[model samples]
Target: MAASPTTGRGRPDSLDHMIRLTSLTRRYGRTTAVHDLTLTVRSGHVTGFLGPNGAGKSTTLRMILGLTAPTSGTVTVDGVRFRDRPRGLRHVGALLDAADVQGGRGAEAHLRALARSNGIPRSRVDATLREVGLAGVARRRVGGFSLGMRQRLGIAAALLGDPPVVLFDEPFNGLDPEGVRWVRGLFRELAGQGRTVFVSSHLMSEMEHCVDRLVVIGRGRLLADQSLAEFAATSGGSTVSVRTPQEGALTARLTAEGGVVRAEDDGTVTVTGLSAARVGDLAAAHRIPVHELVTRTPSLEQAFMALTATSVEHRAGEVAR
Candidate 1:
């Protein structure tokens, strides 16, 4: 594994992986929030933790950070439990909730207090503020700031320790387009520095472009864990679109050869259950002149929907007429 560029002062030298969760499970009363989730978050990449509402994402994160005790199993950071670590913040930096900060204090003051408690220098607070673009309003009270500003302040506080493992939960909640773009770049930079960046979000479009690895869960159970490219490649199969002047003849030949064909709106035939190469060859054998033949791969959102269809916890009911 590559070394993290954002290594803090107290980073352990012997550690390899940033986080390891072994059979981690959590429950509340009669309900299970997380079910035997075993995952390893490696360094030098951005991993996206994805799930629908009530899919145990937040519960797992809380367990990893030692904010909530797991009913069973273990979560370790640098081969040590978070609660057992002498200075937990120095090993992992997390932004679980933007509203967790103290409302009465200014942004700078809040960060300074956290730094002081963690034995970090006060100067680091300002530096972090500037890094997250909150230095201009560092003196403004957090309660008076907008949601986006508060989110930035929370991120600044998380970076005060400059830990190798950084986690963000819905960091793009209130961010405008510019802020969202900045966060995307920031995650890439952090990962380039060889740091472990784990972010959780339901926004598949954003995750499609931002994350390298994906850990998808549904209803407290693991659904799929794979790279973005692998996930898309293994999602059933691709559709082949072919446009020919002899649409009727092509459709009949394609269907006869075990291809599911559907007439598209724009005078093209959409072929599934067959490969593009096979379709092209069949068209050639029948002497059908092909104007256009293209294979369309499933988008990230489409693949995710198909994989998690059975795992969705809540469904919008049909409205009353």
Candidate 2:
């Protein structure tokens, strides 16, 4: 039986290792787009590269692909620099900008040209187009393609070489809900096959569902590098919700026990710094009738906001009057 198109053939040797960045820095005149950033994108996991606008996400990606020169340090994939590799596309496939393609040629023709340049087979062009759901319009001129179609074309180009390491910068920008879900599943499938998938997006909600690891940066500097679960746990612990007829007593007891308690409009109390078991035990001891009790973990959006509060480049109402 043939392997599914979604699942590339067995993991290639070229993707057996990780991508390493050592003291990577890029400066453009007086502005530093990327600071001394040392990080690793491990294989078999989907890593989300997150940062605010002007936070250097694109610059870092460009440097990784060897499209832009770094001012200092180095970025290496599988023990070889991208620019130094004889066939770089075979090792690393990236979708940096959707609009970077030739507008005059058809989608299939454009991808065939790229495949030819990178020593990829001609048949892979149509295969990738089908994989990206662009086979129906493969012969249409790219000049009239919508932003979403262009994005799919870019992703097709990235997969043309069947590279082990894939990088996508804001790939979900112009996609609809179905497209978003498809891309999400595609990333997971790619990573499941022991490939390194690094995606950059400003949508915390999207990354929360798709990414296993996160690499957050601000002002060109690395801020947090951790798994999604670790980030949520360390930034702010879970909050316990409690509802009782004796709100005053529960609040007082929780507050006295060093738990930050806030009463909600619906007569429920939100307590932090205390576990649900502890709250229930306390209520039992104090004879407080509990109607509802639940623990809620902080959402990824909340955690990201808390983590990047200090790293934001633009703040609302900061303009001069």
lDDT of each: 0.84, 0.88
Model 2 TM-score is 0.95
Deviation of model 1 at 167, angstroms: 0.8
lDDT of 1 by residue, 1-321 (tens): 111233233433433557898999998999999999998988878999988888999999999989999999999987888888766667788999999888889999998888877887787887778777887888888989888887888777777887788899999888888788888988887787777899998788889889999888988898888887888777645799999999999999989999999998999889998999999999999899999999998888888888888878876894656
**What lDDT tens digits, residue by residue, belong to model 2 across residues 138-239?**
899999999999999998888888889999998998988888888998899889888999999888889998999999899999989999999887765689
Q: Relative to the unseen true structure, what is the C-alpha lDDT of residue 134 in candidate 2, on a scale of 0 to 100?
A: 86
Off by over 4 Å in 1: 1-15, 318-321
The TM-score values for the models, in the order shown, are: 0.91, 0.95
How far residue 44's Cα lies from its native spot in candidate 1, in Å, is 1.6
Top-lDDT structure, candidate number? 2
At residue 150, give the lDDT of candidate 2: 93
